[model samples]
Target: MKTNESEYDRLLHDIYETIDNPCAWKDFCSHLRESVGAASVHLFGFDRQRDLFSWSDGFGLANAEPLERIRPLYRDDVRLSWLRAFPAGKWLHCGVELDCADDDDAGGTTGFALYPVADGHRCVALCKLVDHQRLTVILACSAQADDAPLAPAARALLERLTPHLSRAVRLYARRFALNADALAARKRAPAMLVSAQGEVLHSNEPAQQLLRATSLVRVRNRRLALTAPHHARLLEDIAVSEARLRSRANGAQAAAARFRALRIVGEKGEAARDASPDGASSASGQHEVLYAFYNVVVTPDDASAAELRAYAALTFYHPRSAPPVDEKVLAAAFDLSPAECRIALLLAEGLALKEIAAQVGVQHDTVRKQLQSIFQKTATRRQPELLRLLLNLPGGSAGAAPDAG
Candidate 1:
């Protein structure tokens, strides 16, 4: 009795793990077959919509070809009838004799047990073969039974396992429903995922082409690069507007603020560029705001705007180039004296310091000192870094590298 108890405990633990990781049901089925010393074991899940029973796993059966053959008998015709008869939440166990008279070996008779899985309108069955006094379990999502009665021990185990098994099925169903809903939403509204930073993350075919020709080209670092800076500015304005809207208590104030921001973005494309010839700058353009109709509400206490903003930033900026250096970095690194910066344009043209001195009307030594200072300040010991820094300036590359002393 102690050994049987130990085995039962082990089986229950295995079952719990299997529920946690549904992918391991096959292994659980094999373990269950061995634990029960059964001739065959199978696990099946029912698809009510498709009206089919699929094999979750099976073990210790010759070829396992007959499992599918028996499924319809248990699931479709017989099981459905049984569920209709027993509408209440209850445990069911039954044994059945199979007619094998036509077979060459003629085993003559076989016995089986049936267990029902029911949650309101949903129902399924688990079946086990009971022959030669050994119990071989197979899970079936069916509602069928034969005339034979269950053994006392088998009845007790079914009673204990039913609640846990039903809960697992309900959890699985809920997850499946959620995934289906998400998929449907993605198909219906792909553009809602676009970041507040005016970078298009996903779009339909038409929107994709429109974005590509305008400011939506991807950066070298793989972020959606806004060629038109106003797009980014528009996003910033939207963020501010959203913040303001959140502060207003009344719907009228929120609506007015939303309209103001909408009109600003609608009249001027990001960067104040006029909308395309087709009036794409208008709110009626290819992109439309879905959130405008809804009132701004604060998230749950556990949620933070900072965390959400981080995710938004991730979508707009490439992970590698995030938090770009500010203009202070350029000012400090280039050691560019204001006057030298104004007059030393010739140095970037690859001119000799003497020629730059002549252009600036300064002594050659003075020009040389300015060039050295420029190199040191810009964090570039060499002229190439200076050249690169100049090239990357907001405007244009000032010129070529200056000659070394």
Candidate 2:
């Protein structure tokens, strides 16, 4: 009994260590898993406002694959309805089956059914609320029998660890907040800051001018409004972008490269007709414009910056008005043939493959073949990704180019 008590105390010590060093969580969870003789131990959190997993880590599982497989369903779990007001330092033990028979919002199986517990597994978990965030820990092991109760000792250990888990997560959250605040200290200009819900918070003079001049984006009801499809994609992208930015290891350049791009097609009929492809094609429209949104963690620098914290920043690229791509640099960097360089330059100028085909007097199929070769050479799979690469290359941004004589 003394040996067991000592092991429990060691596990408790590990929880506290995680507050100062977040990576210490891996060691803690591994220790907890071994101490309890359990199949798995998982500690994870969800940001209710952002609707994304704040963080998830576990032992006896392959990465987060199991959790991610059911993430969509887990987010809408009715059992979590009590999360907002859950008592701190309290725990619950759910047997082999969860209450998942009800219909979710999409008229599909409820989130509980998709949760990680398998048919023969029993679970003991603690759930708590930290501001608008919900954190949980699940300890699962094979059930002795369908109706057998959990070992009393295992249940007691989890209950004992509950308060410590609560404190650890609260302190963990604070560390992230401090990191975000530090990132906000860097000066940014010509950038538009927006909330996760797409509400406009701040924009510099150049940014506002660009927004006003283009039909691609609009401010409606004090929020950035877009076509229904684009708006849905925007929300999805923001959640992903913010989650990646929250990682202490992800730097600005890596985050920017991973940003999802949006295509905003204009409503003008004439513009569409002029750039239309000749034969059967998959191009949505000729007047489509691309915008890449980079997530920015905004901790208000001033009162005018609003009470905003943890928002996103958008950087627009106007290919038409932007300086021409330096073909010499492009050819040198990506090893492009003269013909391929001509195609690449037009692409940088916002011309779709169909439009580029017409402009260069080549068949659509011929242009498509060249594009495939370009994609292979540059190690990109999508049009938006290739464009982002080009627009970030030398002389891509207006400031990177030489002064006009």
Candidate-wise lDDT, in order:
0.40, 0.57
Q: Which candidate's TM-score is highest?
A: 2
| Residues 1-405 of candidate 1: C-alpha lDDT, one tens digit per residue | 112666667656666765557666556556655543333445544333333332245554344323434444434344234432332224433343433344434223333323232221111224332111111123532222222243455445545655654555444433222222223222211122234554434343322323433333333333444334544754565465445444543562344233222211122333222347864433222432111111122222233435322112112211111222224434544656675574335545567767777877888788777777776666667667766666445311112212211
Highest lDDT model number: 2
- Compared to the true structure, candidate 1 yields what TM-score? 0.29
Which digits, one per residue and each the tens of the lDDT, describe model 2 over residues 1-405? 112888888988898988666778778878877765555566665444434344556666544433553344234455454443444454445442322233233223222222444534434433442444333333233322243434567667776777777767766664323222122222222356777788877655545545544556667776877666887676666655555444433473356345555666665431222223663323334555646456555432232223433566676654432345678778888899998999988998889989999999999999999999999999999889999888667542322312212
Residue 95, model 1: Cα distance from true site in angstroms: 3.6
Off by over 4 Å in 2: 1-3, 62-75, 96-122, 129-149, 176-215, 220-288, 291-405
For every model shown, what is its TM-score relative to the native structure? 0.29, 0.44
* Number of backbone collisions per candidate: 13, 0
